[model samples]
Target: MPHSHQNRIQAPQLAAVVVACIALFTDMLVYGILIPLLPLMPAVSRSGPAATGLLFAAYAGMMIIVTPLAGRFVDRRGPRGPLLAALLGLGMACLLFAVGGPYWLLLVSRLLQGAAAGLGWVASLALIAAAIPLPKRGTYLGIAMSMVSLGTLAGPPLAGWLAREYGHAAPFVFATVVLLIDGALRIAFVRPVPPQADDPATALDVLRVKGAWPVVILIAVGSGVTSMIEPILPVQLHEALGLDSVQIGLLFGLLVIVAATLNPLVGAALGRCSPRFLVFCGVLLAMAGLLLLGGGARHAPVIAGVVILGAAIAFLVAPASTLIGVVGARTSPPALGGAYSLYNLAYAAGLV
Candidate 1:
């Protein structure tokens, strides 16, 4: 790297990367911590499938309302302020679960958490786009994705062990502490970068841009395919395929591992290619996975489908964010925030 380029990269930017990675990790960890424990929830286990589905919906419902607003807040106020506030909210939300609060409390915490999550994710992405040069953005995004993948991969086993040894609440406590620490580090190390967009108010206007809609469609479909697996896998494996929890865990773990390992390489490759091509290939791969999943085959087929899906995610997510960044470059900071917020909304919606 040239001296000027090296000089442009400061400790704060590096810290922003670390903070974003850790924030992503903690977010995934907190969310996945409940997976092993959810079956233990009285409502989930005893209630009918319809009721249980409602409970799940209740938890995720807030994301729908909070994401776009978070982006606007980041655009107007900058990342450092909102990021810290969001992290603190996440920490408190996790702590609420740790104390074994009532279902109502959990519901409230989840809603608050959805807002925090939207802001945290948007802020982190915005920070990355502002701190890193465009040419290197894909690689950084890949690294960020892998960090999140690693967290999701690691969270289950850790939470499972905690639940088994200590109790369900133990994992929540751990998540709270991790999030707090992450927040503190972010506060200490990260500085707000100048806004990247020209106008937040008009950023949504870009939705009319002929090219942007394809990216949105791509995000929605890709996210939906990924979301489908989480709900179906355990039942399909246990009921249809006759695998035990241990086996299911191993297979799922492998998917995260593979995805994490591949994401950076995929991102670097994306840097060398057009975002559109990479995203298209990602969709094709995910579609293949979905086909295998719905085909109702044995364990091998299931695992194959999962691997493909993970690979598709590894390919698609960073490029999608990159596309948003590209689109926002012509707009104002608030518009940039709106664009990212829209991306998060698409992602969260897809997950639903």
Candidate 2:
């Protein structure tokens, strides 16, 4: 468990965590919403799927490449700067989408958005880890993580409805408004409480921890394997089992919701007991879920797989994050952000 001079939850830190949740939700929601439309953008304009795919690829690829540097910056400066930058960049990306800009401009916007998101996402976790006590960290992180489900739950249907009712640009405008508001809240209130004596180290430091590199490899492989499953599972089910799209969405959505629901419980268990053991178990759970997912036995089997995977993710992700915080506090405070950045990078690299 990570010990801080701070005891219990402070008001500002709580507020920051809430704001961070909102920010993460909005950013992720925008990404989710944009993904469905990326291929469509070319059809709407002179550019085609190839061009739009380039833009999407640029965003994702650039984000991966830049994450380590972004993590280092957040480690040095704390969350405020990166958090604000993320909001601003997201807002600009929304505006660019709204404008239906030239391909080059769109590509630039995506790169900016990705870099900003990487920074904010890592920094927000670092801030929360710093703010919350070790015992309560999992529960709080679970709560924060749930907000991700909330955004995802809302984003797809909301975007569809807006596009149906108000036209294509409506979703972008709506997301932009949300981003702006989220940014304002973060900037107005989410300053880091104080600088702590976290260690300053380059990415190489992550390699020095005896068992840490294995965790990274596990996360990367897990993320890569899961990433392919996540976006296509519902569609694959709909086609394979003749289920309705809504049902597929529900099943897929439930996976995240379940993960969010379980995170705190799993975290609390780790807090009370052995974190490393839980992490290992969590990884095994994920692998088991993957095996189930691969079976494609029946609708029930697939749903079961999704649920198990969700539970596995909840168990693994929250505790792993908390463990990183623990390591950071022990080694140096600033490394918290860097640790998370490397984690994110490993996940992203796996996706690629």
What is the Cα-based TM-score of model 2? Answer: 0.72
* Runs off by more than 4 Å, candidate 1: 1-7, 55-60, 99-103, 129-142, 191-206, 235-248, 261-288, 291-298, 312-322, 325-339
- What 10-residue stretch in candidate 1 is worst by lDDT? 329-338
Provide the lowest-lDDT 10-residue window in model 2. 328-337
Listed in order, each prediction's TM-score against the native is 0.79, 0.72
Per-residue C-alpha lDDT of model 1 across residues 1-352, encoded as one tens digit per residue: 5955754756767788888888877887776665445544554445544544454455455666766676677767777887887888888888776765565666666667776777778778777766766556546765776676777787766776776678768788888778768877987877867765434343366565557777777677766665556545655666688764445556667767766677667657876898778888887998897788778568778888878888888677757666765665544332454565567777777766
Residues 14-86 of candidate 2: C-alpha lDDT, one tens digit per residue:
8978887888788778876654444445443356434544665566677787676666666677778878888
Candidate 1 clash figure, as a count:
9
lDDT, residue 225, model 1 = 66
What's the lDDT for all of these models?
0.69, 0.67
Best by TM-score: 1
